[model samples]
Target: MADVVRPSDRFRQGMATRRRVLGDAHVDRASGSATPFDQPFQEMITEGAWGTVWSRPGISPRERSMITIALLAALGHDEEVAMHVRATVNTGASREDITEALMHVAVYAGVPAANRAFKIAKHVFDRIDAGETGGGSHD
Candidate 1:
């Protein structure tokens, strides 16, 4: 069985990391939608992914961000990829790092996935360049 995280600790840590990475507005919106049905899943992710894995000592956040981007891109999870792209800055993953990861994804995952990931990344980067809170563009 996986080591379960305490609910209180998970919520606190997850909310903190989420706010740091995704910004307060995004975390607020997500928190606002918490319902009985989805709350458990949210907690699980908060504890397991955000608190446990992300907070682990094995790898730097930048490396984790790179791995996350690659996995999300390869899986064609556009929304998640976009979210992580926004997290790159907070994780200390430069635009160049993201570009390199996507290029590797292009070779291993497929050009289509890489292309779509690039487009999403570009959109996020553009938003950043435009002084928007969570958007950025590569091109």
Candidate 2:
């Protein structure tokens, strides 16, 4: 049998990690916006995804950022792509790296997805250049 993790403990740990990777302001907004109906869903993300997968040491944040960018672009997760692009500063993935990754998305995920991703990324980059960046992650 596998050991179980307490939900409270996982939530605490996940929030810390999420704040570190995604930035405090973004985490705060998400946390603040949680309603009763959505609280459980929020806990799932805070504990499961952010706490478990993102906390694993198998991959560096930079690598995770690149992979995340590619997946988001490939899946047409437009809002999430912009958020992760803003998070590039923390992940150490440069705009060039994102561009290169998007090229791969074009080849494998279809050009329309990549085209939209590029457009979304451009909006994100423009915000970064203008110091108008927003949330950390939408997913």
Please report the TM-score between candidate 2 and the true structure. 0.89
**For every model shown, what is its TM-score relative to the native structure?**
0.85, 0.89
C-alpha lDDT of all candidate models, in order: 0.81, 0.84
The residue-level lDDT of candidate 2 at 67 comes to 90
Model 2 stretches astray by more than 4 angstroms: 1-7, 135-138
lDDT of 1 by residue, 1-139 (tens): 9998555876678667767766776767676777988878777777777777777787888988999999999999888898889888788999999999999999999999999999999998888888877432110
Model 2, 63-109: lDDT tens digits are 88889889998998888888888888888898898889999999999
Best by TM-score: 2
**Best of the candidates, lDDT:** 2
Q: Name model 1 segments beyond 4 Å from true.
A: 1-6, 134-139
lDDT of 1 at 111: 96
Alpha-carbon RMSD of each model: 5.8, 4.6
Model 2 worst lDDT window (10 residues) = 130-139
